[model samples]
Target: MTISRWKPNVTVAAVIEQNGKFLLIEEHTAQGLRLNTPAGHLDPGESPIEGCVRETLEETAHAFTPTALIGIYMARSSHRTGNKEDVTYMRFAFAGELGAREAGRALDEGIVRTVWMTADEIRASVSRHRSPLLLQCIEDYLAGKRYPLDLIHVDESVR
Candidate 1:
């Protein structure tokens, strides 16, 4: 008998909407070019909120201050380059203020560009989305779904 430990890949995403548009990244993925919100895997020694801020900056070259959590979601995907194992992702989605892009800062590697799209445009282009959660998060934001930032408590030990 073998004991197994299962852990989902925890990640954070920033749902940055401003002036009737939502900020998204057009990046190259295993599935080819795809659009996604500013999102990435949470790093060690950082809380989910901090991870969101970092990911938003890295992907969009902009500062973000998360105000509310949109939701937490889990999904299984099989997109590894050469692996057949399905990976489960646990994502914490946040909505907040997106600052101006940093001058002379380069977008993260694999990110082609940053673009703003209206909800209608996003809905129409679901086929190009990197993940199903991308549109879900945006729609949730538009639907006024927001949870207090304190909803998830990160112990000091985790930070």
Candidate 2:
């Protein structure tokens, strides 16, 4: 039998903050309603930064300009109640500026609404988080950890 390589799903997230509140999205998960950062998978042919910007707009109805890399995280889930297989995700989280909302724009499927929460509020609701990374990203952002956006280089062939 041939050994198959394990591949982790790549995702991007935006840690948008203003006036001490961080922006988060409430969405329907197989487990039920959950909160997460404005995040999603990286699309084919797009860089992580580009994917982060796109996902932020799609999930929160606001434009996002990623300024710095917040952190890279890897997490694994073992047979979640409704999931048939174990899964791992590699996330590139960024800190960014969130712009004005797009008029009448609809959020991505499964997204119910966007809410701004203080760090205390987030800490209080850990049980409702979609993933631990949701709060870890925020904590990393609050601790003033950031890497230059140029840290990631996409090959010209991908353009």
Candidate 3:
């Protein structure tokens, strides 16, 4: 008998805040237009921190330097009410600084535009978020929760 291996999709996100507002992107999703942090899957041969930087640039057209790890989160996303097609995502959340946008850089394909929203605005629009973890990360950031980036290490094999 053969047993299939189950693995969660690993992703990285940037939690960038400035002047009491958080950076976010409005993007097209299968469910419709949705909001999310600058985030994406961890690509082959890249660490979570590197993936976070790359995703931020792709989504927001800005350079991001992650300084600390916020928290790791896992969420099960379902297309509908059924559990059969649910996908579990393990996200490595990081707090970072966003540099000025690159001139004339196109946003990621599905990204409509960038928006800075307050915590209350984000809380009120939970229905429009790509995943529930978005708010959790934001709230955690607001609460001053953080860890050193050294908590995660990438081996030379993946470098």
lDDT of 3 by residue, 100-156 (tens): 889999999999999999999999999999988999999999999999999998999
**Model 2 residue 74 lDDT?**
96
Model 3, total clashes: 0
- Where does candidate 2 have its weakest 10-residue lDDT segment? 77-86
Compared to the true structure, candidate 1 yields what TM-score? 0.95
Model 3 weakest lDDT span, ten residues long: 77-86
Using all chains and alpha carbons, the TM-scores for the candidates as numbered come to 0.95, 0.95, 0.95
- lDDT on C-alpha atoms for all candidate structures: 0.93, 0.94, 0.95
lDDT of 2: 0.94
Give me the candidate number with maximum lDDT.
3
**Across residues 53-150, which tens digit of lDDT does each residue of candidate 1 receive?**
99999999999999999999988888668777688999999999998789999999999999999999999999999888998899899999999999
Rank list by lDDT: 3, 2, 1
Pairs clashing within candidate 1: none
